[model samples]
Structures are given as C-alpha cells and as structure tokens.
Target: MIRIALKMLVGDRPKYIGMILGVMFSSFVITQQSSIFTGIMTRTFGFINDSPLPDVWVMDPKVQYIDDIKPLQDTQLLRVRGVDGVEWATPLYKGLLKARLSNGVFQNCNVIGLDDASLVGGPGNMIKGKLEDLRRADGVIVDIVGAQGRLAKILPDGSRQTLDIGDTLELNDRRAIVVGIASISRTFQSQPVIYTTYSRAMNFAPRERKLLSFVLVKAKPGVAISDLARNIQSQTGLKAVTAEEFKHMTVMYFLKYTGIPINFGIGVLLGFLVGTAIVGQIFHNFTLDNLRYFGALKAMGASNGTLLRMIIVQAIVVGLIGYGIGVGAASMFYHVSKKSELAFRMPAELLIVSATAVTVICVIAAIFSIRKVFKLEPAIVFKS
Candidate 1:
C-alpha cells in the first residue's frame, strides 16, 4: 500500500517539483532573514562580549547603550570600587574620532580605552602582535576586520594589503600606531575599532572635562552578580547591571527604536503565505487527479485511515527534502560571507523554528489533500 502511494506521488513529476520549490523558497527566506537579523542584534553588545573579565558594568544613569556614552566623573570609579561585594573595578573610555589614514583618507573610528593597570576590557583575541605592545608609546590595537578593510590599500590584482603592526594614523591631531591586530566581534556601526590605554585614548580623543566613560567591575568570589550590581548602583548612585542584562538592554533599545525587526518579520510572513498557497494548491490538484485511484482502492477494501496516512507520509517526504536543501544553502551563504562585513549567524534556536515552520506548512498541505480523499465514494471508481 505504501509503495503504491509513493508511486502515485512521484508519478506527477512537474507538480512534485513545483511543490518542492515552493517549500524550498519559503524555508530559505525565513531562515536566512532571521539569521541575519539575529546577527545584527547580537552586535549591539560586541564591546561587552569582547570584555570577558567584567561581571558588571557601571555607567551614567543616562547611558542607554554602548554607543550612547555619557561620561562619568573620575571619582565614580573609586565609588564603584568601594561598594560591598565588589572585587575590583577599572575605567573604560569609549568615543568616536576621525582617523586620518596614511593615504589621506579620513574615516570615522571607534576608540576604546582599557584600564592602564589591568588592561581590562581590551580585545580578547589577537591576530598579530602582542597585547603588551600597547604599553609602548603612541600604541594602539586595531580590529582585524577594520585593518583588512577600511585601513588597507587595494592592490592592482583586486586584492587588499591590510595595515600592518607598524602602520600609523592620526587621531584628533595625535599620531597613533597600530601595534597589534585584535580579533573581536564586529560592531553594530561597522566602524574601524582602535584600542589603547585609558590615558592614551584620552589624549587621542578631543579633551573633555570628564573623560571616564564607564566602569568595568568584577564581583568577588561567590558573590552574586545581580546583588553586587544593585549594591554598586546604590552606593555610587550610578546605573549598574550585569553583563547579560546590559546586552539585553542594548538589543531592546535598538529593536524599539528601529524598523529592522518589523521589516524582517514582514519578509518571513510573506514567504510563509506564498509557500502555503503554492504548495497547498498544487497538492490539492494532485490529489484531485488521483481521486479515481483512491476510489478504486476503497472499492478493493482499503480503509480511509490508510489513505490518510499515505498522504501524510508523502507530505513529510517532500517537506524534509525541501527543508534540507534550503537550510544547506543558507549555511553555505554564511560560510562564504564570513570574511566580509555581512553578518549571518545560525543559532540552534533559529534552526528549530525554521524546521517547525516547514513542518506546519507540510501538515497544512497534507490536510487539504486529506479532505478530498475522505469525501470520495467507492462507486466513483466504477463510473469514471
């Protein structure tokens, strides 16, 4: 019985292929768009994620996100350090500056200042040169993507020669040297990233009355980060939050203020509707063309339950094939764009959501066919 049902489905080659294409197109759009959206949202906390040493972040009450810097007074750092359950705290400086490249091109850059003593909040990974090199005069670390991208020179062969450790640039009229290349997550702004000691960063940045931007703190052993954050906030009168909480805050700020989420949602929803319509119509017609055969089976003592199961099996087979190909293509896109500025991350949760969506589409398509099979009378086979 299963073999006969399988043959019936495969017999209509054009409809089978059309149905598969519909499913594939829908799956690809949903998975790819969602993954890209997730990737961009994740970058909202790139700075926090790069600094693994900080259990909590202390900032001005007005600061909503990393890019929205509200400078804190230098004394705020000492106040945070004195709070109970606080193991240690260090200053972090963040600001934007215009960088004059060696080629005379000016590019906007994000400058990060790490604590002079512990060098906390510095880049976690380095592609070349040592972090300790930042201790040298006029030294800074550049993110690998920025070094290979905006800072590099295009060669005759269309390849790029990236800025090296000894490359120099001017920041706010002060000379800065690239002493190291750091491997860090891409930032949301897609600007070139430069890291240096807190003092050096202050010098490179336009001098301000209060230069301290943030306080990176770690909780004492066995101390609950949430409790410590609350304590620091109360003692210093500054806003304090755990790393995860800060990340969520940043992501939420973007989602609330921007139309990115709505745009992606619309695209996914349209794909779902199109897939359902195409697959549903084709499957229904396919079932209608095979009604005589289904009626003949009924006349030969086959039950409606058996016919229903066969249709479901056919839908499942088509769904799986289409989904696998679609997801595989999406994965390939991520791999190919890894070196570029394109951000695409496929988390496990996204994969599950996409799979569930494909299953729903298939079930809906199968249900449409099931109704027609159930309505057939055994005598119809003898007449037609």
Candidate 2:
C-alpha cells in the first residue's frame, strides 16, 4: 500500500511541484523575517553583555531597558555595599558622550565609566594597550572593531588610521586620549563604545551624576547572588537581578511591551497560515482532478485508510521540499546580512522549531485533501 501511494505521489510531478513551491515560499518568508526580528532584540541589550561587572546588576527600579538612563547616587552605592554578603560594590556610570573625531566629524559613543581601582564596568577586552590605562584622568579605551569605522581618522593618503595607542581624542570637549583599543566580539546597538574613568565621565559627560546608570556588586564567597541582589533591592529601593535574570528581563520587555516581537510574530503566523491554505487548496484540487482514479481504486475494494495514506505521503513530500527551500533561502540571507554591519544570527533551536512548524502546517493541510478523496464515490468514475 505504501509503495503504491509513493509511486502515485511521485508520478504526478507538475501538480506536486506547485504545492512544494507554495510551502517553500511560506516557510522562507517566516524564517527570514523572524531571524531579522531576533537580531534587533539582541541589539537592545548589548551593553549588559559588554560589561565586566559582577554576576548581578543593580538598576533603578523604574528602568526597563538599558537605554533608559537612571544613574544611582553616592549614598545608594554605600547602601549596596552595606548589604550582607557583598564583597565589593562600585558605582559604574553609563551615558552617551559626543566626541569629535580627528576628521572633525562628531560621533556619539556609549561611554561606560568604571570606578577607579575596582574598574568594575569597563570593557574587559583591550587589544592594543592595558585596560588600566583608563585610570588616567584623560585616558579612554575604544573597541577596535568599533573604532575602525566611526572614530578612525582618514589621513592625507585617503587611508584609514587606527586610533593608535596613546592617541588623543575629545570627549565632550575634554582632553581624552585613546590609551587602548578593546578586542571583543562586536556589540549590539551598532554603536562604538569608549571607556573612561568614572570621575572623568561625571565631569566631562553631558548628563549629570544623579543619573549614575548602574551600581555593580560582586558577591563574597559562599553567598548566593540572588540573596544579595534581594538585599540590595530592599535596602536601596532599586531593582537588582542576576545577569541571566537581567537578560531575560530585557527579552521579556521587548517581547511584551514593545511592538517588535509582535510584529514579527504576525508576519510568521500569516506566512504559516497562508502557505498551508494555499498548499492545501492546491493538493485538494489535484485530488479532485484525479478523482476518477481514486474512485476506481475504491471500486476495486481499496480501503479508505490506504487512500488517506497516499494523500498524507504526498503532503509530506511537498512539505519537506518546501521547508528545505525556505530554510536554504533564509540561510543565504543570513550569511549576506552577517558580513555587512547588520546583526544577523539564527540560533539552532529557532531553526529546529521553525522547521517543525512548517512540517506540521504541511501535514495538517494535506488532511483536507485526503478528506475529499475519502468521500469520493468509487462508482462515479465509471459513470463519467
């Protein structure tokens, strides 16, 4: 029965090809759009991942996303340190600073200022010079990848020059030097990052100290981070979360409060439904056009179950082929976008789930076509 069904499905090349294309088109649209959406969400929290602070992050209770500026006070920092089980607490300033490149073009850089000595919130990875260079009153560190484009100087030869170690640059009109270039994975937000001392950031940056964005806390040994975070929140009236919890919070904020995930989800859902409906309709029509053959089989005492199996087999074949094309096309787009300045990445789990969803939609769609075949009267073909 299986062999006969397989032969019948494979024999009709033209009809099945239409079904395949429909399925593939739907799957491809959903996968590519979803990947782009995921990339944007990752960018929203790039700063959280870039920081070299404690396992827990303390933020203002009112802050939702990292971009929301809510700097803590000196008193708040002391309160956080007073919490039990805290090894050390430091005030890290996060703010936007505008600097004039050597080319005289103004660029806004995400200024992450670390506390002196503790250096809690600075970029941990530096390529050209030591991280401690940020301790200088007029020193700053920039990401090598980031500095290459926005901050780099174009020399008289029309060639790009790296912000060399010990090079001087302006941060808010202050005398700031590029003491080091950080070597780290490209950050989200697609903005260049520069690290400076907390004091310099407070004095030179535009935003004031009441806006200290975060207080970083390191836990002493044998103390659970969650417990310490809870104490900090209670004492300081601030929100504290583990790094993982903070990531989840960001993900949830985007998924729930923002329109990004919802918009992408709508696209994916529409694609899935439209694809399934079109494929189902086409498969059903194919079965209807070939109703006489099915009727003949039924007249010869072929069971409804056998006919149903044939329809399902045809459906699965179309679904598999369409899914492959869609996923393949999406992969190509990802590769192209990744090489550019875009943040395009597709996790393995998302791929797996998306493929499974396409397969399910195809299978469900085939059921409609199979029902029509099962209902056909075997005697009808003879009459016609």
Candidate 3:
C-alpha cells in the first residue's frame, strides 16, 4: 500500500513539487525571521556574556536595560565588596560619547570604562593591540566592526591616517589615542564600543555624573548568588540581580517597554499563519484532484484508513523536504549577513525551536488535508 501511494504521489510530481516549494519558502521565511529577531534580543547583553567575575550585578534602582543610563557613587563598589558572600566587586562605567574621526567627522560611540588594572568588563577579542592599552591617560580601544567603512578610513598623513596600535584619538571631547582595535559581538544598543580607563571615563563623561553606574560582584565559589544579591540590595539600597535575572530584565525592558519585539512578533505570527494556510490549501487541492482515484481504490476494497495513511505519508515527505530547503536557505543568509554591520545571528537553541515549529505546522496542515480524503464517497467513482 505504501509503495502504491508513493507511485501515485510521484506520478503527479509536478503539482506536488509546486506545493512543496510553497511550503519550503514559507518555512524559510518564518524560521529565518524568528531566529534573527530572537538573536538580536539575546545580543542586548552581549556585554555581560564573557564576564569572568562573580554571579551578581548591582545596578541603580532605575536602570532597566543595558542602554539604560544611571549612576552610582564610586564608594558603592566597597559597599558591595563588603557583603558577606562577595569575593570581589568591580565598577563598570558605560555611556555614549562622540569621537573625532581622522577625517574630522565625529562618530557617536558607546564608551566602556573598565578598571585600568584588572581590565574587567572589557572586550574578549583584541585583534590588533592588548587590553592594557587603556592604561595611559589618552589610551582607548575602538571596535573593529565599529570602525569599518566610513569610520574605518584612515587620514592621509601618516600620523592622522593610521589606526595603528599606539595611534591616539579624541573621545568625549578629551584628547585620546587609539591604543587597540578590538572586536566584540555586535549588540543592539552599542555597535561601536570604545574602551577607556575608569578615571578617563569619569573625567571625559558629563559632569552630572555622581555614581559608578553599576557594580559587578563576584561571589565566593561556594556562596549562593541569590543570597548575595538579597544581602547587597538590603545593605546598599540598590537592586541586586543574578546574571540570568539581569538578562531577563534587559530582554523584558526591550520587549515590553520598546515596540521592537511586539512588532517583530506580529510579523512572525503573520508569516506562520500565511505559510500554513497557503501550503495547507495547496496540499488539500492536490488531494481533491486525486479524489476519483481514491474513490476507485475504495470501491476495490481499500479502506478509508488506508487512504488517510497515504495522505499522511505524502505530507511528511513534503514537510521534511521543505524543512531541509528552508533551513539551508536561512543558514546561508545568516552567514552572509554576519560579517556586515547588520545585526543577525542564529544560535543552536533557536534553530531547534524554529525547526520544530515548522515541522508542527506541516504536520497539522497534512492532518487537515487528510480529513478531506476521509470524506470522499466510494460511490463517486461509480457515478462517472
């Protein structure tokens, strides 16, 4: 019976191919778009992903996401360090400032002030220079990805045109040098990140600043992070959050407060629904066109159950084929856009979820088409 079904489905290969292609295109769009949106949301905290410090983050009461600007006194670091479970505490300075490019054009940049000595909260990928380049008063590092293209162009004169290891530039209206060219995961908020010393950031930054913004707390190996967060919050009058909690908070801030996720989600849902409906209708019509043959088989003693099974098999075949094409297309798109300044990424977990989602939609559509086959009358063949 299975072999018989395969021959019939294969005989009508042209029509079925059209249906499969439709499904393939739909699945590809939904999977790709959803994965990209989720990836961008995840990258919001790309700054914290490589932190080799403690498990807790202390932020100002008002700070919501990575881009949210708030300040804490320089003294707050000691307060968090004094917490019972804290192994060490470090101050993180994050803000936006303008840098003068070699071409005399000013480029807006996200500034990161790391502890000069330890270099915590700095980039993990240093392409040209070492992280210690920020130790000098005018020392700074710019993102390779950030400095590409227009901002990447060097000045004509050797001194101004070069982004060499020790080249200096101005940051936040302060005379600064380009010490290193580092690379980091392109995040939604900070695409072009500039690393500088804590003192330089404090001085170059706006004078309204009275705080350190946030403190990174490293809990002792055996210490409970939750307990440490609670203790720090109780003592410092600031909010203490675990790494995961902070991630969720930042994600939520973008999703709920900003319209990005809402807009992206709506587009995704619409794509899924449109894809399912279009593919399902095409497959259903294919079944209807073969109804007379189905009726003839029924008269010859083939059961409705047998016909239903055949329909399911065809659906599964189409689904698997479509999924393969769609996922392959999405991967190609991901890699092509990865090197550009554009924000697009696909993690493994998201890929799995997207595949499963498309598969479920395919199965459900196939089931819908099967229901119509079960309704065909054996007498239909006798009439003609």
Top candidate when judged by lDDT against the true structure: 1
Q: How much is the lDDT of residue 297 in candidate 3?
A: 92
Task: Please give, for residues 298-365, the per-residue lDDT of candidate 1 as tens digits.
Answer: 89989999999889888987898888888888898888888777878899999898889888999999
What is candidate 2's CA lDDT for residue 30?
81
Model 3 C-alpha lDDT per residue in residues 1-384, reported as the tens digit of each score:
888777777778876787678667766787788777878887887777755464898988888987786888888888888889888888888888787775677878888888766778888889988888678658888888665543465646534233556655677667877888887877886447888888788876878647487788888888888998999999999999998888889889888888887777777677678768877887777778888888899899999888888887887788778878887888888878776655666777766766776677777777776777778788889786
Better of 1 and 3 by TM-score: 1
- Number of residue pairs clashing in candidate 1, backbone atoms closer than 3 angstroms, sequence gap of 3 or more or interchain: 0
By lDDT, the candidates rank as 1, 2, 3
Global lDDT of each candidate: 0.89, 0.80, 0.78
Please list the Cα RMSD from the true structure of every candidate, rounded to 1 decimal place. 1.9, 2.4, 2.3
The parts of candidate 2 lying over 4 Å away from their true place are: 156-162, 183-188, 207-211
Model 2 lDDT, residue 314, Cα: 75
Q: How do all models score by TM-score?
A: 0.95, 0.91, 0.93
- Which pairs of residues have clashing backbones in candidate 1? none
Model 3: worst 10 consecutive residues (lDDT sum): 155-164
